[model samples]
Target: MLDIKVLGPGCANCIKLESLVKEVVSEKNLQANIEKITDREKFLDYGIMVTPGLIVNGKVLAMVKIPTKSTLEHWLEKESSI
Candidate 1:
């Protein structure tokens, strides 16, 4: 299964990103372990200096801005296959 983490501080953008991640995962029918990290220290641990960050399989794929649904889907699909 894919290990996905959405790092943020509970801002609007952060919440949006988390929702989008869930949407994509469900749409793709992926077996993923999705986690939400809200602690600032933990965000830094992932090297995320932005409001929203996306990590897939231990790799940071996005930060600051949310990716388009298609892009997000592509990323998740690529990672799931590996």
Candidate 2:
């Protein structure tokens, strides 16, 4: 299963990214472990100084911006196979 994490402090962009990720996962029926990370210390642990970070399979994918659907799908597809 794909292990994904959305790192944020409950900002608007963070919420939007989280929602978008959830939507894509549901629509694709992909097996994934998605988590919402709101702790600032944890973000530092992940080397994320920006809110709305997307982490996939233990690797940070995006920081500070909401990813597009296609970008998300591509990542999901890649990670699901692992």
Candidate that scores best on TM-score: 1
- Every model: Cα RMSD to truth: 0.6, 0.7
Model 2 clash tally, residue pairs: 0
TM-score attained by model 2:
0.96
Mark the 10 consecutive residues where model 1 has the least summed lDDT.
Answer: 42-51
The model with the greatest lDDT is 1
Write model 2 residue lDDT over 27-75, tens digit each, in one string: 9999888899999999999989988899998898999978899999998
The global C-alpha lDDT for each of the candidates, from Candidate 1 onward, is 0.94, 0.92
Please write out the lDDT profile of model 1 over residues 1-82, one tens digit for every residue: 9999999989999999999999999999999999999998898888998879999999999999899999999999999999
- RMSD over all Cα atoms, model 2: 0.7
Point out the worst 10-residue segment of candidate 2 by lDDT: 73-82
Clashing pairs in 2: none
